[model samples]
Target: MSNEQAWEAVVVSKSRAPLDGSNLYRRVTVRHDDGPEEKIRVAREAWKQIEVGDRVMKEAGQDPRRA
Candidate 1:
């Protein structure tokens, strides 16, 4: 995938769970502009940066961003 292309999506829901002992994993469900909803795993720090209803730019296998 091209790194320059970021898909636009809206944060729909978020959940957190323990991953690999002390590390925490955040899962977020996002609705994309093209009409599909996806569940993506993200860093806890990145998850903390977003909220439901927030619009973000999502790159494949990368953290979401607001722009």
Candidate 2:
């Protein structure tokens, strides 16, 4: 079995925070139908491509053995 997992979620909110001198990072909060809300950090450009109420698929986790 693979250690990776994916979920379908709805975007709840979005925020931005300073990364370095002038760079910024975006944080997106999403809620799953069967789970609590989760916050994910994404690139500013990628973040701009999504909006609240949008449905998105999120994936995480990796098997070290595959590395």
Question: Relative to the true structure, how large is the alpha-carbon lDDT of every model?
Answer: 0.79, 0.68
Q: Write the per-residue lDDT of candidate 1 for residues 1-67, one digit (tens) a residue.
A: 2455669888899898786789777888899888899887766677888889988786765657764
Backbone clash count for every predicted candidate, in the order shown = 0, 0
- 55 Cα displacement, candidate 1 (Å): 0.6
C-alpha lDDT (0 to 100) for residue 12 of candidate 1? 92
TM-score of 2: 0.69
RMSD of 1: 3.0
Worst 10 residues of 1 by lDDT: 58-67
Give residue 27's error in model 1 in angstroms: 1.3
Which candidate leads in lDDT? 1
Please write out the lDDT profile of model 2 over residues 1-67, one tens digit for every residue: 1237756778889899776768777788888778788777766566878888887674567211100
